[model samples]
Target: MPILGLKAPGPSTPAHFSLEPLIRPNILALQPYRCARDDYSAGVLLDANENAIGPALPSASAKKVKVNGHSDSNGTSGASASAEDIALETLSLLPPGTDLNRYPSPTHDELKRRIAHLRGVPDENWVFLGVGSDEVIDMLFRVLCVPGKDRVLTTPPTYGMYKVTANVNDVGVLEVPLIAEGGKFQLDEDAMDEAFTANPDLKIVFICSPGNPTGTVIPLPAIRRVLENPKFKGVVLVDEAYIDFAPSNSSAAQLINEYANVCVTQTLSKSFGLAAIRLGYLLAPPPLIQILTNTKAPYNISVPTASIAASAVSDAGMAVMAEAVSTLNANRDYLLETLPTIPSIGDILGGNDANFVLVQVLDGPKGKVCNNRAVQVYKTMAETRGVVVRYRGGEIGCEGCLRITVGTRTECEEVIKQLKDLLA
Candidate 1:
C-alpha cells in the first residue's frame, strides 16, 4: 500500500512526507493557548496573572554563574548557593534587559537556533524544545498515536522509557527484538520489514542509537532502510541521547533535510553533563514543530532553564563538553581493554560507542555466562563494595550482562577490581 501523507518519490528528492494524516485531527486544528508572553513581554506588563511584584524568591548576592560545572568568577565562594539564589542569579545574567517576572517565551527561538546550529539542522524553525527528552517522547506519542487505538514500534533491550511513556499515553507497543548474535545489537531489517507489513498502521518506530545498557550504535544504513521502507508511513523517532559519546557522524540528525519523516531527540543530560537543567529538544520539519508548539504548554521552557541552556550551547560550553567527552571516551577505552582481561568477565557486548561497557559476568574463568553470578556481582558491589553497575542479564539476548558506565580512570579500575574479586 502507498504510505500515508507521502508524495511520490522523485528522481532527486526524497518522497515528501507530510504529518497531516499522522497527527491527531484535533491537534492539527488546535488553537494553542495564547499565553501573555506570546504577544509582548515588555514594559508595563501586567499580564499572565504573574506576581507583578517580581519573582517570589530570596534576592541574589554575589553568586557565581555556573554553566555545566564551569563557574563564572563573581568573587563569591565558601558557601552553598540556595536554589532561589541560583534562580535569581540565572535571571540576572540574561543578555541585559530580560527578567524573571514575565512568563518565558512561548517559543524560545534563540535557544532553539543555537541547538539547531549545534545539531547541524537548517534553522530554529526545525527545532522543538521540551521539558526533557521524556517530554519530547510523550509529545510525539500524544500527537501521532491515538490513545487506545494506535500503536508504536520499539526495538527491545533499548531505552525502557519509550515503553513506559507509550503505556502512560494509552498507546500499544509492538516490540521487535534487535539481532543480538555475537553481541552485535543491531536492527533485524528483515524482521522489521515483516513487522511493517503486518502492522501497517504503526505510527512511530523508536530507534535508540548508542542505546542505553547496550552502548551500541544502530548504523545509519540500517536506519536508511527503515526510512526508505515503502510499506511503513509514519514518523521514525531516533533517540540519540548518547550521541556525543559515540563516534563522529553517527547522528540521524543529518537525515532531517532529506527525509521529512525523521525526528531526532537529544538532551543536555548526557554529554553536556546538565541533567539538573532538564532541557531536551526535537529536530524535525517546521510543520510538525508548529503542531507541537501549538499543543504544548506556553512557556514550557522556563527562564532559568533557557538561560542555563543558552550558556550550555555557547562556544565556551561546547569546548567544555568536548574536553569532558574526550576524557569519558578514553575512560571507555580503558574499560573495553581492561574488563575483558578479568577472569570472570566474558565477551564485551555491542559496539562500545557510548560512554559505557556491557560485559558479561561468568560463573568462573572458563565457565559459561551466568545470570546468578551477574546478579550477585551487581548487588554486592552496590551494597558491600560501594561499586554499582546495572545487571541487564534478563534483557533479550543480553544474558549475564552488566552495564557499567565509564567513569574516571580511578572509578574504572575500582569497578574492575571489585568485579574480579567478587567473581573470584
Candidate 2:
C-alpha cells in the first residue's frame, strides 16, 4: 500500500511525477524474468541450447546467389528454370539465424536505442518494445489497473482497442466524448476534468491523438491540462500511432520529460509501413518503463521482428518513411478537397492529421445523413465493388460516416469516381 516510493524523473526532465501510486503494487514488487541473453550475447553463444553446426535449412545469408544462367545441383540450367523453380530454390534456403531452435534477445537495446533517438527520448531506458502497440496496451492494463476494481478514461469514437482491452481486463471505462460539431475533434477538457474528479480511482486515461475514426489530433495544451491535474493521479496514455502523419512538433513524446505520469505509445505499423513486423513501443519515465518490463514476457519480440524494425528505423528507412508520409499527407489533402465536391458528401470531419479521413455521406434533398444508405454504400464498395471504405455509422457523431484511407492519387481518384457513379 506504499505509494510515491519510486524516483520522480531524470534530473533534467521537468517531470517530477511519482509512480508508486500509479503502478500496481504487485508489479512494483515483481522480479523480472531473466532470459539467457540478459547475461551475455557474444562469445561462444552456446548457453541457450543453440545448434552447434548451424540451422537445418541451407544458409542463404552465407551462401552466394548462383546466377540464373548457372546449372543447379540437379543439373538443370538455372536460366531454363521457370519462375516457380526459382521460388522453390529460394525457399529451400534460409537466412542466417532464421532457425526456430534459438530464442530471441529478451532486451533489444539496439532497437530501443534506434527508437530513443528517433523519438527524442533521453536514451533506450525511456523505451519498451511490444509485439505491437496492442501488446503494450494490454501490458498497461495488466500492470496498472486492478482487474475488477480499477477504471480508465477514454474518448468516444476513438480507437476501439482501449475499450476492448479494458473490457477484457474487466476494468471500468469512463467515456468522455470529444467535441464533434467542429472539425476539431479535440478533447472536451472540462468534461474530462469533471470525469477525472468523479473518478479519482481511475488508473489510466487513453487518448488517441490524431484519433482512429476522427483522424484528428488532441492538442498539447488539452493534454497538458490532464497531465497537470493534481487530482488525476493516474497515467495519461497518449496513443500516437499516427504521430508521423501529423505536424512534427505535435507529439507528446516531448512532454514525457515534463510530465512523469504521461506514457506515449508509438508503432512502426503506420508511418514506417512495417505493420507486418509488429513492432510498437512505449516511452515514459524509467519507473513505469521498469514496471512494464518486469511484467512483459521475456522474449515477446522475435529476432526477425527486431531485425526488420532495426532496418526500418535506420537512416535510409527514415528517409523512405518520411517520403511515404509526405505522399500520404498529399493524398489526404486531395481527398479533403475532392470529397466535398460529390453531392452525397457532407461534413469531412477532424483535423486530417492522420493518414485517413472521416467523411459524412449525405442523402438527397434536405442533405440529411442516412446511416442505412451509408451502410449499403459501404457494403457495395467493399463487397460488390472493388473499392473499400469503412462505415463508422455506429460511433458518436459518425452516423452515416465513412472512414476513408488516403490511398495513391490514382486510387483516390478511382474512389471518387466510384462514389460519383454509385451515388448518382
Best candidate (score: TM-score) = 1
Give candidate 2's TM-score: 0.88
Q: Tell me each candidate's TM-score.
A: 0.90, 0.88
Q: What does candidate 1's lDDT look like per residue over 1-424, in tens digits? A: 2223222231222464556788898777786557666567668777667777655555432222333235554533234866655555555556554556777777788999999999998888789999999999999999898899999999988989999999999999999999999988899899999999999889999999988777889889889889888778898999999999998999999988778778899999989988877999999876677778778887788887898899989999999999999999999988888888889899999888888888898889978999999998899999999998899999998999999988889999999899778777
Candidate 2 positional error at 49, Å: 3.7
Q: Name model 1 segments beyond 4 Å from true.
A: 1-16, 59-98
Q: Indicate which candidate wins on lDDT.
A: 1
Residue 245 error, candidate 1, Å:
1.1
- Please, what is the whole-model Cα lDDT of each candidate in the order they appear? 0.83, 0.82
lDDT comparing candidate 1 with the true structure = 0.83
User: Model 2 over residues 297-406: C-alpha lDDT tens digits?
Assistant: 88899877887788889899899999999999999989989888888788888888999999888886348988988898889988877999899989997889999988
Clashes of 1: 0
